[model samples]
Target: MQSKTPISDPTLLQLPLDTRTLTIGGLAIKIYGLGAHSASTPLTCIHLLHPRQQTHEYMTGIARSLLHTYGTQALICASFDSRNHGARTTSPLANESWKGGNATHAEDMFSVYHGTVEDLRMVVEYLGVYLRRVVRHFVVGVSLGGHAAYLALALPRVEGVVSVIGCPDFVRLMAARAEGCGVDVRGVFGGAGLGPIVGRLDPAAVGMVGLREVWRGKRLLALSGGADGLVPYACSQPFLDEVKKAVWRGELELDLEDIVYEGVRHECTSEMVREIVRWFAACFEDMDGGSLKSSLAL
Candidate 1:
């Protein structure tokens, strides 16, 4: 299944912002206005985050496909290029000479995780006023978006988190990338500068403690590609282990479902999109195929 499917080009309704800013520590941020098509009350806000290299438009296709199949509407969908990427990059040779070496790339990821999570929380807070037409609110994210979704779920308002091929163990992914390049995790994470920050932010180790504190009794729906080269199976295994451990301790009763598609690579496939749509449809009530304009209007 090597999941690389073409992104869908969708026509969406752009919404006017109501003037709100969420403060995350010292940083005050606003949610990018993607669009607002009113759906039935209790709308499902599908916030699709991009993979490491992809753009917001790449995930928009997946979001539109799911919305089309399930007859759903997204209140907001947004993504930003990570540090050392796009225009915000600080790398000196980002255009020609940069090979995306290790070192600070991991730190950039940490920043992305933090920034994305803050944005997700702000969106969730904004939507909480009117989107809660139902009892449960779901947030579905793919890959790096999945990581952001997990962080969003840590908030009390998020009812469920559906992550596909999300890298929960940041250190492990770095370590795997390092190992693939014949480097050492110990030397890398234990080195002078990278070590201390990694110790503080590594999701596999101490970083996830706050997440775990909020993870109790939360429903987690996850999927992974069996043949993902970038995100190895071993990496996903530890996350599953954490979930299972939480389940055993009565900290979380994980109604977790894992679907591993054979031959699927790091990208998402059309079949996988269909599966996600089917699952999302089940989460809604009285889903009837109707006109996009009317169905979205509450």
Candidate 2:
């Protein structure tokens, strides 16, 4: 894939936005940053995923910012509400945690985000057909969306990922939450017959060998808050450590960036957003230079 130069004129950044909403696979998808010139240029689609309990509209600002920064370069930002969220809300109780009186918090949360990965795959397939142009896909997910971003690595078109305050190890995160909430973790995710269910869905349970195959040649930028009480970095540390070790041992090839902002809470700060944009810019540069590997080729 030959990289095209980004439009340098600042005034050109204000090009008329080609925003639209489409219903695909029964999910409403909002797209931004495409214009009349999009078909002539190679396109990069970035999916903006919002936090838990929030709708796709919450990602509008980030989508607009990305469009403003790379709109002239044929960049398009897309977003959709996760399952049991926004217009997809079938049961509000399923979104709650154990403390909120949801007995199946672990399974419920995993199903929503895991289901998101499936939704993303379907969307990616349709976008390629709908756009009728060369397009590379990337993802930027916050909190609940971030968790889905990690799982999306299994997909073919997801070339890069930005996980903001997301956990790769669902079991670790749920276990900690259950312990804090005085819920029996084993009953929910571990021991008994529930272990297999989680092992089948959890990324960490896939083990390093499986991860090497899924993560090879991919790029991941994980932004976490050091002081986040809700989804602390500790929940993801063990999994990340193994990833680093795999790279060191030459068992995996990946571009991984893990940063924890001090004093930041569970929220996605402005600094994190800026970092995400910067990372995407760098990835584009690499892609143009033929340095970044595409999942499609893998």
Write candidate 1's Cα lDDT for 96-206 as tens digits: 211355455555566676676666565555554433443234566677666666565666666556777776677777777766666555754665746665454444554
Indicate the worst ten consecutive residues by lDDT in candidate 1.
Answer: 289-298
Candidate 2 pairs with clashing backbones: none
In candidate 2, which residue ranges exceed 4 Å CA deviation? 1-18, 190-194, 294-298
Model 1 alpha-carbon miss at residue 298, Å: 18
lDDT by residue for model 2 over 232-268, one digit each (tens)? 8999999999888888889988889999999988887
lDDT to native, each model:
0.55, 0.80
- Candidate 2: global Cα-lDDT? 0.80
Clashes of each: 9, 0
**Winner by lDDT:** 2
**Candidate 2's TM-score:** 0.90
Residue 181 displacement (Å), model 1:
1.4
